[model samples]
Target: MEERKKFTFSRRGFIRTSALAGGGILLGVNFLNACKESAQPPVNIANLNFKEFNAFIKIAENGYVTIFSPNPEIGQGVKTSMPMLIAEELDVPWEHVTVEQAGLDTENFTRQVAGGSQSIRHGWEPLRQTGAIAKQMLIQAAAARWEVEPYTCTASNGVITNQAGKQLGYGDVVNDAALLPVPENAVLKDPKDFKIIGKDAINVDVHKIVTGQPLYGLDYTAPGMKYASVLRPPAFGQTLKSFDASEAKKVGGVIDVLKFGDKVAVIANNTWAAMKGKHKLTAQWNDTTLESTEDHDAKLNAILNGSKFEVRREDGNVNSAFSEADSVIERTYESPFLPHNCMEPMNFYANVTAERIHLVGPIQTPAGTAKRIAHVLERDEKEIDLEMTRMGGGFGRRLYGDFAEEAALISNGAKLPIKVVFSREDDMAAGTYRPAIKYRIKAALKDGKVTAYHLKEAAINSNMYGLIPHFFPAGAIKNYKVETGNYQSNITTGAWRAPYTNFLAFAEQSFFDEIAKELAIDPVKLRMDLLDNVNDGEDERIEYSAARMKETIKLAAEKGNWGKAAENVYQGFAAYYSHNTHVAEVVDITLQNGFPKVEKVTVAVDCGIVVNPTGAINQVEGGVIDGIGHAMYGNFAFDNGKPKATNFDAYRLIRMNETPKVETYFVENNLSPTGLGEPGLPPAGGALANAITAATGKRMLTQPFIEHFNTDTREVRG
Candidate 1:
């Protein structure tokens, strides 16, 4: 057999060789050397004058076009939708374009992240410009050969035709085009003329996924790699004091026991050996002053009842409005801390040497991980190469780079390339949970209308990021005041899916439903009246689109047949705006043997513009199911500073049989797309809770509703 040729590029960051099999002209753009943070401002791809834009396009001699997508794909379908933008502006047929996931090269790609649902919002213009620039160069090359003015030539479906009727395929002129100067200006196609965007497109890697191909971080491998499992402190706020690893070293295939900080790692030749070795090790922890759940709850409630707190948002005089009210409604809603439970668990691969560190895994923040690794290993940011792999599930758990950093430290300590894997128990018990919160809301109504509202929220760790001030209904109410109290803890907390809005929407929207019933008014109409009174011009203050919210609510109600459910079915409505996307959900639920069961859900979304309709619908459907699962039975409690549910055996998850039918629809518009990942999630829990109240005369104030109903007996529990 002959030796295979290598793939090489020039020092200028452009690849100009036919080294690739099946001859083609490839164009690759390099990214600027910037800071290692994913939150960068959007780039305008219409102007090619920018010094850095790292994207790739290849015009194969066989007429096939290949584009490299530069964002990490965590099942959000950016790999498919992003390429459609490029192919559309290139004036190429969608069927002839191929998309591939690019590696993490900060010098060639910026903000390669998977969280925040920002990939489509930011990549839209830059990727399109990459294709348009390539198309311009090809047209110029063809015009130079035909000896005609470039303006007289028009390109369509990979072919350029002149006024004289002479045609040239892009593959024929790509060689000459590679030598031409990069154009400073490239005109974009009109939205009406778009052939690929806003249309349904299949995921590029669907075939590999269904055929049992290895695409996730857990399935990654490298030469002479060792597997390791770490034994972290059994509980938070504890430190390792001593360890006995003699028995672990005696285990078959066990290589060594490495100690780093408060954790000890068992390294072996394979995963099973590493796990078995880890189980045999015995470690003692110190300062195990365990805190109880009851203590934390008491502290949070005390803060909520006290007057000392930070003022997040305050409007008109709430005290005077409450004093003048005809009636007052008050309730306190609470949620427990929840874990991410990402399907594949947490695993990372790191190869460290004297020169540099190489890391790869399914992390949401690649740039942040690089920065963390550089800081930990005392190496330059450029010395670390971070490659992103498809994640099994993110849900904001992968946003932290602790796993990657730990892997790098272990690799350096062990003097070998190491793959650190977390067992299901380890991952579930690890903290970084969604902060548990308590909300005490009071609404004063006069003349059958809400006049004043006050919300006092108590939370563990940090409070919501501008949730109390910027969330909707703030401007809708005349007299509104928001206050928050916080109690710090050793347990780590961070973003989980929709973050604070996940439970906040459930609490606030459910309260609105209660108010409508007490006032003897239709719940949908009550919200609509509030929206009518809301001034859309104050968008800067409220930070939400009132028009879009109203549209989605109206559309969802119409499609779900709100207030006109069939026999044994009752409908509940809720709408919320978050992550720059507006979403409304109507749930149809029925009681079976005194237990509420969700039958169906109809969702209306206004994410401005839908890039891939199929992908957007999938996101909405999945979010609805996820929301239902959490509302029905998603929770984890702490006892003696340790999680009670260490794995799925104790903790529960929604199964296929329990999933409700979800129907999704989008509002048509020409605005730039926002995000679909987290917005669809916030309102779903609230709608389901409202439907439960409709089906059963009792309201389930607490989440995971499992405490009130028995699954086997289908009876209300005392």
Candidate 2:
């Protein structure tokens, strides 16, 4: 036999393997993989072997592979798509691969976050390398058995074949492969050879979701766990004075009531009893500095017109360009604070004891939440164990783990295991809403060409980040300026969906259409002309790829039949670059009973490589629908520091019958993937707005277009 080299392994290496009890191999990457026996379903961890090891892939006695996806499954489809990257490189048939959601393991995984649509973008390479290394080890094991060079031996479909026609299944040699030295580097497959990636794969949890199995946070439970319904401050800028819980204590199934800072928690045997007991309580609040929507509106408007402004970005001389211009077109757009309104209400389970703390819930930031909990409880981080359940829907809501912290605190206070559940009213009324904002866009038109561009943003709490100022149309305009101002308020606000770009894209793209109309140029042509001014690599600040953006624009225009709409059919165009992805959209609408009825939306995206076409399409369609629904009807406000709407009965959402058909096309490329979850959303609103304008000669300068144009009746609301 060839001299075999003895090697020692370190945790930092890309691949780690160990022999299983029943003559199999357990392999893990820095990202980790699944390790489950064949006797149980991949998700059923009750009988999991190698529990202490943070491994991902496990080749059992049979030729089966299980991959544990480390990121949270916030309906982004990473539970299915992340494994495809590994199975493709492993040369295993997709049918033989089983995927399971992995828990938080700080030792093996990095960037386990699910926000920013980065799960796939970040896992694209390392996940593939993991499988490639495993496949290389298996091939080497087979080569050593057959006394042939590893290069001559080939692995395919869970089997290795040597040059002399000797063959062995991965399961037959997995024990032997476990002893082989892991390769420092393994060759990756070419894009042309991809089998599972770029192909359609159904969601791994579809069966569980459709059958209403226990997968979401709402379905989680623990032995002897009591339910909690918390009553927070009734309104913004309010503090709790006192509560009379005597009547609440008398309610059936009510156990006990505990008062925490600024809130009261009702503990009961079940959620219904907890809620009932909470409703029976009488609480007094001290409301100072009570604010209203009108106040916010005035404050934002004042900031826009005020001289005090922080210039985010400036190029050339905006004053000189504006002063010398022939005409200046300025328009202001406004948006209201909105709630996430996830399908499942917020819920978390916590068990705090003298020895350790156990937490389970749907949280986007697991490690950060755990750390925060440790800080709050004055406990060591090692004593806390958190388990993430599948979320019904996040949309940036679960990014804040206030609910989890509440569960932990309530459990610690009650001295028992507790599950904190929020009612729909509680979910909406006390949500960390999307900050209300207003944008004032101005353009200096000189001799039929745009000379300068300026944008001013006034928001509720904070302004847009530095990256927004460097997005599209930055390098294209010679004299461009971006300014922002904010009014700090007591109401809490944070990231919602795509954050700044969600509304910014609408304002900027709609302004572009207005510019096209003023110049009497085709909307598509105007955008193309502006893009022609942007030179690639000339400015490092420009994050958008002009070449890629132009391709998407051209594709959307062609597919949408931009200028060839039939009579009575109105078309609108908008394009945006955000989340490192370029997207172009065209909305088509027709007058139905004198009201614009959205017919279809054509979208073209350049997100580099498409991981799973089915999941990608689903994400695109969901984003477009979400964008249209929110832009048309989503609205929230506060009256005297109290939320105006608390439930869907008062709030409005898009009806299924009113949803438009979304057609998506991708510009295929072999480059690394970018974001997908939020990119498709930003442009849909602007496209719909421009299309409505084309159908009816009205400019939409505010969100919840229903406020300006009534969808129920044929007349304008104003």
Candidate 3:
């Protein structure tokens, strides 16, 4: 008999084996704090005679495998996709796998963020290795019972088989397997032998979504939980001066009215009561110094032409290159502040006690929010339990902790569990918006080739983050310079989807189209020509994969039937690299009446190994729709320092009838997977703009292009 090695898990609830219905093995895990560097299992799962493994996997006696996905599912499908990584290496039939959503538990999980599309990218190797370790332990247990060498046993579809034709189900040996020590290292399956990854898999929540299950933050409820609505200062720089809640107190179902600096809240038995109470309350604000939208726009424009600016990236002498070039093209682009109008408006439930606080919500960053809540409550971080619910849409808006903090404050003051909900108007009026920006690009062309490029971006709050000097065209051109200018404002700005790339791609990629036209070269050929000079090496400064970038561009062009549109249909193309992913998009658009109507979109992405092709494609399609909606009609304005677009009546989104037919393709590669969440979005706007330009022979220099066109007349209104 083989000698068994004993191992113990260090986390709070590492491995706890229990009997399931019928005869089966049930395993649960908690993450080990020490095992952050590799994919090694922290505790042995095969030691079931007396002990077991940690939080993720649970194998049943009947051969069903349950995997826990520990991340927020904000319509991007990480819940269904991450578990596939583990199921693939465990060699189990995909049909036998069931996925569960895990609550926020830091001691058992690490890096549980859902933004930047990094869930799969970060969990790829470690998650697969975990499944491999579990499979090996089960194989060893089966081998011990059969009196055979472990190396001679093979496991497939949750069962182990030996060369002599003896077979045992994983459930049959899980108890003894739980007694054996875990393998120090397990070999990951080769890509060619993969049965799950890169294949189509439906979202784990699809059934619940279709059935109208309670999975969103707005649907969350707790015992004795009261709904609360807040009346915040209307303007960015304003504060509450005075309020009269006399009439609000008479509203039916109204429980209590509380006041916090700069805001007032009405707590009631239900949502409608709270909303009515808030509407009835009379309030006045001190808006003496509030700045209007025009003020901010003028400041940004002044900074763009001003001399005070910081150079972020400079290579070779751009001045000299321009002086020596045959022609220099300069154009400016602007994008306005836009809101993240999530289908489910901002809402959070918080229960506060003297000892601890419980927070549940649809947030993008739970850990960060927990820390902020702890600070606000003056409690230790460990005392707060932050649980994330499925978000209708995050789009980088939930990253802020303001809403969660408000809920905590209300709960603490009321001494009860309270759910803070924002109506459509409130969410739009108070949310942090994407920063408006001005981009000026100058390209020096010599003999039909881009020799030098310069870019200066000016913004009201702050410049784009992660925008390095060596961004795209950095290595493609000899002389490059990137500069930034800043103007101060009271408007709160935060990340929106792809962040800077959302607007930057529209500016840079569309400018490239202009350069291509000036040089009388096909846009595709111009891009490929520029890419020819890019070095494909292990350079840290190279933000984009030259090979992969070229691949996506060629693939998108081919799949889109580039330059083959009919007389009335025009095709425009744009490619971009962000979040370690390369994406190329081609838009087929036609002028309907006076407005550009997007007919179809073709996208090619290279984000390394795609874990779930179906989910990946869904993300691409949704991102394209989001991009087009914002570019066509999404814009927020301010008058007297108050948000103008406070509801759907003023804020418009892409309807189903207007959404284009989107087709997505992926390049096959053996590299580790990256994020697809935000990459597909950055180039969509640029491609649509390019297509519009092609159709009308006019360039859209400012975003929310709907504002500049007369839809009924088919002419420019600007």
Steric overlap count per candidate: 1, 5, 18
Please rank every candidate by TM-score, starting with the best.
2, 3, 1
Q: So what's the TM-score on candidate 1?
A: 0.93
Which candidate, 1 or 3, has the higher lDDT?
Answer: 3
lDDT by residue for model 2 (61-118), tens: 6889988767889998888988999899898999898887767654334466779888
Report, for every candidate in turn, its global Cα lDDT versus the true structure: 0.82, 0.86, 0.83
Q: Residues 1-718, candidate 3: write the lDDT tens digits.
A: 2233233333233343444334455544433231233223434334442211224787877778988666778888888888888899888999898887666654434566778887787777667766777888899989999898999999988889999998899878877876776566677887878899989988888888899998999999999999999999888888899999999989999999999768899999999999999999999887766877798888888988898888988878999999999999999999989988888999999999988799998988887888888887889887887777899998888988799999999999999799999999988989888988889999999977899999998986665453556668878888989998877677888899998889899999999999999999999999998998888774467789788899999999999999998889999999999888999999999888757889999999999998888889888888888888888888888887788889988887778899999999898888889988889898999999999899888898999878778766877664
**Cα misplacement distance, residue 46 of candidate 1 (Å):** 28
Better of 2 and 3 by lDDT: 2
Q: Candidate 1: worst 10 consecutive residues by lDDT?
A: 32-41
TM-score of each: 0.93, 0.95, 0.93
True-vs-predicted CA distance for residue 603, candidate 1, Å: 0.3
lDDT for 215 in candidate 1 is: 89
The global Cα lDDT (0 to 1) of model 2 is 0.86
